[model samples]
Target: MRRRGIDALTHRAVAEEAALPPQTVRAHLPTREDLWCAALQYTLTGWVRRGEEFIDRLPEPLTLEQAARAIVEVATVHPAEHADTTRATIAGVYERYIQSGRHPELRPLIGRYNVELTGLVARVLARHGRHVQPEIARAVLAVVDGTVVYRLAEGETPIPAAIRALEVAIPLLCPFPNDT
Candidate 1:
């Protein structure tokens, strides 16, 4: 349901997709909203896990550009593992969660996950020390996200372009003080 969108998914559809009885699906999920939320949470957990794993496998003290390149490479190489559409959907749901009066229970979980993602980016930027500020770190992330979205939409390869762009832009955006 989360992959396809809520408007197009029904309990029966999910049951059929899972090769299970509707009753069984109801027994586990109970409500369409619940199912959607669970699917989103599952996807979010997977994304975070995959990102952390990629970071872990890399050598320590990665430069800002290297960290950014590593992340984009990992994501592009494993599109199935980190679907761009799913990330966009999660972002939408997160926005809705903030506006909705109900579902206070979900806010903490979503907020924490968002913070985790931001902290990962911040850590990468920290390697550049005085060169990169919090705002610049955020802008870098936005650029990376936009690049990924464009690549996905166009069905074009982005790993090389993303790496090159970031490599060139990072130094300009956060130039060494002495060089200035």
Candidate 2:
């Protein structure tokens, strides 16, 4: 679904891509929606996994900007060595994330991921020195995700503009640091 959208995810196409038989694809996916759901889950899982890995490497006492940077960066980025291949993968992931909106059943999955991600953000910030309420963490996510979508629409990478936006939003969202 990276080169195209979910519309292009046919059993035959997947079979061809996987070098497997069409019947095998059908047996696994069962329904077209199941195929789409699996594809969406894979994309979302990659995104979430990258974030988790990145945050684990960070130092404690993380600032809001650092948290925001980590959140936005991990969503669409790979380390310097992996950038070329991962760029398309990340784009596919982001596209699938937006495309999930077309299926109403997928929204709860999206919401659950968002809540888990937001909780991670809040926990990471609080675990270190920086602390923000869950509401603020969710707003921080909105800023990062919105900036990513905007940059993607403009054929730009999301990191730079997203960080610039967070520089602005972080202060607006948290005027004073909340005590741990």
How do the predictions measure up, each by TM-score?
0.65, 0.80
Query: What global local distance difference test value does model 1 have?
Result: 0.59
Go through the candidates in order and give each one's C-alpha lDDT: 0.59, 0.71
Residue-level lDDT of model 2, residues 111-136, one tens digit each, is: 77777778777765564455688898
Instruction: Give lDDT tens digits, candidate 1, residues 4-81.
Output: 554455779888998999999889889877765666577557767766766666666677667667645433334333
Q: List the residue pairs that clash in candidate 1.
A: none
Shift of residue 55 alpha carbon in model 1, Å: 0.7
**Candidate 2 residue 67 C-alpha distance from true site, Å:** 2.9
